[model samples]
Target: MRYISTRGDAPALGFEDVLLTGLATDGGLYVPESLPHFSIEEIRSWRGLSYSELAFNVMHPFVDDAIPADDFRAMLEETYKEFAHQAVAPLVQLDTNEWVMELFRGPTLAFKDFALQLLGRLLDYVLEKRKQHVVIMGATSGDTGSAAIEGCRRCEHVDIFILHPHERVSEVQRRQMTTVLGDNIHNIAVRGNFDDCQRMVKESFGDQSFLGGKTQLAAVNSINWARIMAQIVYYFHASLALGGPDRSLAFSVPTGNFGDIFAGYLAKKMGLPISQLVIATNRNDILHRFMSGNRYEQHQLEHTLSPSMDIMVSSNFERLLFDLHGRDGALVKDLLERAQQGPVSIEDYRWRHARKLFDSDAVDDKLTCDTIREVFERNEYLLDPHTAIGVRAARNCRRDPAVPMVTLGTAHPAKFPDAIAESGLSIKPELPVHMADLFEREERCSVLENDLSAVQSFIADHWKHA
Candidate 1:
């Protein structure tokens, strides 16, 4: 399977190449040249397969000739074996038709683990075979930093540098990335918001001559095609569990970067009977505004209870816009360039077509807390602020009652205890047994200015030379 840039200027690449070459040279995200479609019978036959088996079935087409079948299966088994739950990604029923898909059971306790774990291993395999070394640069609002570090820490051929907004993340979120001390894993606390950190990463990718051009820079963020490819599997897993293919499923994803819900969009294109895809967001809701009001503009990034979704620029939205504009790369380039200064409206027909399958809502902190409290009182289930937003959106924006509405549980509640405390509940959420001493661990981190040159110099100093 070949991958093509959303902007259509970069050369077409195979799956392995796409995995490492993230954020195309022309400032676009890579998407599959042709999505492999599964027939109803083919999807139905995967009902009772194990998680790894299901993953192999759903993802092997994208793997193509990159890795042999047996080797890829072995790597997949190893990747998911670290998950705390046997089901890898499990579903818990809340109401008659509403449910929560638990995706924080992995090592880092966030939905990102589902993909990052696999991505780390895939990168190691590809880099080892080619005798190459890479530097992974990523920006995180909260969860992606810890998850990416944990995923790639053991890799010998790669060094990972994650930047998060200083003092913006919760204590737990900050420590999760900082406490994992290693020469290979470096954490930077930037004196800015999430969007600032993200912008730095994008700019660095745009011009990697800072690395002296000796080593390639890789991405652990969702801009990497591998991350999105791995995310597509869980949608299939959850839909099949709730009786899919025959019965349509609806997903409400608490998305900031737009990668997770875009995976759902891909699942539907691959013949999963998906009825609705809800774009759930916190106060920093560019995606919500676009879906609900046709305004794809950037505003001041807000710091809410859900820090992970505190983003002004939705990087992956361009991938969807590429499709929404009928895959015209020149048009995408024109629109995105125009959007830099302010908001740009798409054609009416395109917006209307998107609304047919996509609906969105933005929840403020009060509503997030209320939803958490209400769900706990009704179902005796506690939700993190991000998941609370997802549940709220699923409840409010649901179009059909009969269809199963599953909210993607993006993070464990323990990661954001401040939100739990703010919810008026006295219950204290505890970390899993493995992370019981998270607060006790000594953290090592460098506080840096939000300047790209300083960040690049830091990476150059600490990065192991190839």
Candidate 2:
């Protein structure tokens, strides 16, 4: 399948190319030329297969020509073999009609592991075949950095550098990334918000001279199509376990970058019987406002309990707009430009169209804590702040009594011990083996101002030393 840039300027690329060149040249995200579909019979036939098997089946269409079938299958199997759960993303019924898809079963104890684990394998395979090395630069609000660091820490052919907003992420989040002792992993604490970190990454890509000068740079964020593709497997797994296309399912995703919910959309396009995709947001609710027809306005960032969702700019939403406009890149570019200048008012019809496929709700800190307390009291379930927002949002939109609603549990509660404790729940979850003694480790990272030259210089210096 060919991938095209949302801005219509970059050359169309195949799966591997799209995976490597994350943000398109025209400052847009890449999307598939056309979505591939799967028949209901084909989806149902995958009922009892292992997660790896199911992932191979679901992702084969997208990367059929990019990677050899046997190699891809082997990679998928190897990528997930170390997961704590045999059923990689297990489903637990929270209520008669509600379930929580436990996605923190991988090494990092975050939903990002579902994709980054596979991403590490894919990167190794591709780089080995080409006999090349790459520098992976990513910006993370919280979980993505730790997951990426864990996935690519000691890999010989790839060097990963993650930039996170200083003092914005939670303590555990910071420690997870900072404490990794891998020589190849570099963490930069930027003196700005998540948007600044994200902008720096984008600027690095835009610097043609710098991009061509030294080490090859790729991104591990959801901007990489492979990351989103890998995430789609869980939706299929959850849907199939809950009777699949036979019964419609609704997903409540704790959305920040929009990639997670967009994967659900891809599942629907591929004929999964999903009724609605609910976007659960914290105070940084650009997505919520867009879906609510109050205009797609990006305000100043806010520090919230759910730090991962503390983003003013939702990057993956551009891909959705590209699809929504029927792959008309010109329209996508125009809309994005307008949205950036100010809050572009989405037409009522367009807003309703988006709302048809997805519903949105925002939960503040109080509601998040309340939901955590309530869920713990009623069901003996302990949720992190982000997952608590999702649970509350799901409860607000719980209309269909028959259709099962699945909320994507994005992170393990241990990642946010303070919030979890503040919610009046006491569950001392075991840390992942890698993070067991994070506090004891001394961190090695550069504190950088939000300047492009400084970031560029850091990359240049690192490449030169390597």
On lDDT, the candidate that comes out on top is 1
* Runs off by more than 4 Å, candidate 2: 426-428, 432-434, 464-466
Local accuracy of candidate 1 as per-residue lDDT tens digits, 347-369: 98999999999999999999999
Query: How far is 373's C-alpha from truth in model 1 (Å)?
Result: 0.5
Encode model 2's per-residue lDDT on 139-162: one tens digit a residue: 999999999988887577888889
TM-score of 2: 0.97
- Residue pair clashes in candidate 1: none
**TM-scores vs. true structure, each candidate:** 0.99, 0.97
